[model samples]
Target: GLAERKKVTHVAMESTGVYWKPVYNLLEAEPIEVLVVNAQHIKAVPGRKTDVKDAEWIADLLRHGLLKGSYIPHRAQRELRELVRYRR
Candidate 1:
């Protein structure tokens, strides 16, 4: 959209266990900020999930800084972590 034509300033993703790695990799550089919230933290009215409402819920939380962000390792640290973890 025209309104978002510029580079994205921040990104928000819901953490589903360890399933967020690929997403983090994709957005690590472009966006100046990245926020990964835990799925357990979001609460909605009792009903079936809808794409529109789900996006709204996540957006609302993100706007208010109410969503907790996941820890992202520094680049050097991340490389070291992967090396150690793989050696095990």
Candidate 2:
């Protein structure tokens, strides 16, 4: 619940293809801040490829406030961009 996360500050999410959009929109609706970072930026060194470990790494980076979020345009701007893209 959003209420339960009142004390929670920042939430970090890896920037996959386009899966992070809905999640970002939902969280943005709340007061909580959402950070979308490049997957390469948060990935561990070579030979450390595990889902659990990847999640842990992201969490650790987010907890320490080390990850920086990429720019996200306003919804209206996004819609306009989409319209232009489809028309092209």
Q: Pick the candidate with the highest lDDT.
A: 2
lDDT for position 30 in model 2: 68
lDDT of 1 by residue, 1-81 (tens): 321577567667778776777777767756367887777777545663886887787887788888889788876788899
Residue 78 displacement (Å), model 1:
2.0
> How much lDDT does each candidate structure score?
0.74, 0.83
TM-scores of the models, in the order given: 0.71, 0.82
Residue 52 of model 2, lDDT score? 86
Largest TM-score belongs to which candidate?
2
Which portions of model 1 miss their true places by more than 4 Å?
1-7, 43-45, 48-52
